[model samples]
Target: MAPVPKTMSGILIEEVGGPEVLQWKTDLPVPELKDGEILVKNEFIGINYIDTYLRTGLYKAPLPLITGREAAGYVVASSSPDFKEGDRVTYLADHSYAEFTAVPDVSAVIVPDDFSTEQAAAALLQGLTALTLIREAAGIKQQLGISQGPFVLVHAAAGGTGLLLVQILAVNGAKVIGTASTPEKLALTKENGAAWVINSKEEDVTARVKEITSGNGVDVIFDGVGKATFDANFDIIARKGTVISFGNASGAVGPVDLFKLTPKNAKLVRPTLFNYITTKEERRAFTEELFELISSGKVKLRIHDVYPLKDVARAHQDLEGRKTTGKLLLKV
Candidate 1:
């Protein structure tokens, strides 16, 4: 085993505010390992929208909290026999924006031999998110219902989870339509297997979607942009369509009227990843599917950018400002 560093660096939020609230310090102690836990010497940390919500206080946390959710690293110490020193692992959990992390053994998954640390860091959260939304949330069962052909519309098509979801749907033989803000993003969406791409900023999304589906709308819509696109999202669904409202990147969505769904006989559901993988059994099942997808090349991990761990504030600013197109990571 390599000698572990005595102290580690981390990003801290002093108060809930703008990007200015992010502070970095070098003197923090490495997280102490607990029973059933392993200490990881983090090599890369994932930058996600949830991290931004935590920093801005939109999602409340204990004041003066370390902020980060996903990271990939080598195990340095452990109380559990499942992981040994020098094993490569990754996890999606809070408090990972540091040089070292003490994570429960169950929460961490060993990276496959084919994947690098960077890919492991970028894939865990978004890949799992995509898996849950498709298999669990939207319920893509053994056979897709629509003989006319099943269509899935994904908002924020160029994002991490969106890209993965598009591929997953495509491999499952669904006609996938995606919405993005720029031509570049639209092209990326197409590269990721979207059958159709709509520039939601410049194009009338509802009109384009209707035109693409020949006025029938789609069978399922995976919406994460929230308030900014919810109305248009609602307008584009077919009768008996299913809408899965997952994340709020633009802002919180409506206090929706259940009556609205009655007119179209549609179903409205709000799903979080936590609910989908509620039990240990469910977690294993979902993750196994996700790993199989990646290992089999049915899904590809898109890494948009990588920055030093100390550049967490810049990463947050880029993501919140909508300046990035795919997954972002911090190289520790």
Candidate 2:
């Protein structure tokens, strides 16, 4: 292995506003490992909507931050015995839009022998988000009770995390109804195992969902579209159903009355992936299940594009514009 360099290439955000704030620099300092952290030479970084939120000041972070949540690469230095130099890993961490990241041992997982760094990067964050959204956030199994398969709805069904949700829900035998604005995305959703796809652009989503569910409404709603689709989720959710609002792709939802969920006894939850995998055991369990699904061909991750680190601004532009579908990655 090469000696670790003091300086590395990365995107540094000094101001918060738009994609333009993501300025690429060659002289950014490589992060130093903490006692329980490992230094990874990042090969590929995952681009998520959270990155966009942090970049635009929608989500708060300090100035001059290196903003990204996940990356996959080879460990180059370690402050813990669980990892060593040359171990391939994918991790959930801070400051990932860079050539290297200091990853907490609790949040990092070794990439399996069958997976590539690109796959690991693309799959980890969004994949686990999908898993935890279904299992932890929604509690699909317990919610289903004796029902063989529950009716579930996923907003932005062709998007990165949306696609994963559709596939994983299908694998668990849910009848998934996915929403997309375009025919291409609707088709993509169906291809990924959605039992039905709603063209959120042209159709009345609430009416269509009512008709599909025979007026019972869906058992669970995985809503990542945020404010744009939040209200409709209540209208289309069945009695005692769960609504997991996991992202703010269409902007954050406003204050809730809490009374809206009262009529149907609906359950509303806003879960962040990080909260679900706080401990090492939790992270490892979810990550292992996600990897097993991918490796077994039960779930597939779609990489929309791999942008150069310097081109992160354009990537963010495409993401916020809703111009691309599936996972976006940055090659370091």
Candidate 3:
């Protein structure tokens, strides 16, 4: 093995506050590789709203932690048989804010020959999240099932995962109703496949969805905006509809009253993406389907912004401020 570096530059959150809490440091040691782990020299890191949750203590993390969950890079050293030096891969791991990360080989996906590291970093985690929503949450397992033309509602329609959801649902024959705040976002959502785009700021989502669905209500509702959109989401949901609240960008959706599921008997599932793909096989299924969509051009991602790794705090600020539309990245 080539000489391992003893230190690297990365952001560390010593205290949980606002974006200002993020601290940059150069003397932090490159994490030691453990059994079954491969060390990657990261070239691109994904910036997610979840990272802001971790940074601001909305979600608990070990204090004084490197905070990030996705990146793409080349393997530098490995103790595992699955990877070798110079293999291009996308890594889904904790503490991915650094220039170098020691990650489990099972948690990494080999980047396709056609993709750049930045592309992999931008799509892997968000795409997997979108896949799980449609496949498991929406209960559209087979092609024929989707051809039935289910009604689907996607909140934050122009978001990184929302755009993919719209395209996937549209490609699978679902009638999509997407909600966004700005004209640009609404237009993007409409172009991607939304049958209707509701300006949540200027219009009532439940009313517009009811008008479009003929009062039957949508069969599937995907809400990543959490508290800000929960009441509207539940209001517009159909009988026995499947609803998933996977993120808390606006604020955490507090405890649910089971009574809320009463009249309609709808299903509400609050899930964490990382927990769903713990095994290698589970990971493979998500990546395989996601890569298939990307390779065939059924889905695409836009790079909203690229900041140097040290500019991570600014990335978080933009994310929390809702100043971005597509995927955000940190160039390492």
Q: Which regions in candidate 3 have their CA more than 4 angstroms from the true location? A: 142-147
Worst 10 residues of 3 by lDDT: 139-148
> Where in model 2 is the C-alpha error above 4 Å?
142-147
Model 2 Cα lDDT, one tens digit per residue, 91-172 = 9988999998998888888999999999999999999999998899877643342247899999999999999999999888
Better of 2 and 3 by lDDT: 2
Q: For model 1, state the Cα shift of residue 63 in Å.
A: 1.3
As for TM-score, the candidate ahead, 1 or 3, is: 3
Look at candidate 1 and tell me the lDDT of residue 19: 77
Query: How many Å off is the CA of 246 in candidate 3?
Result: 0.8
- Reference-based lDDT, each prediction: 0.86, 0.92, 0.88
Root-mean-square deviation of every model: 1.8, 1.7, 1.4
In candidate 1, stretches whose alpha carbon ends up further than 4 angstroms from where it belongs are 142-149
Q: Which ten residues in a row have the lowest lDDT in candidate 2?
A: 139-148
Candidate 2 matches the true fold with a TM-score of 0.97
- Can you write out model 3's per-residue Cα lDDT over 1-332, one digit (the tens) per residue? 57778999999999999888888899999988899999999999998888988988888988899999999999999999989998999978989999799999889989999888899999988989988888877776545644478899999989998998898888888888999999999999999889889998999788889999899899999999999888777788899998899989889888888888887889998887777787888889889988988889988778899999999888888888888888999998
Name the lDDT of candidate 3.
0.88
| lDDT sort, best first | 2, 3, 1
Q: For every model shown, what is its TM-score relative to the native structure? A: 0.95, 0.97, 0.97
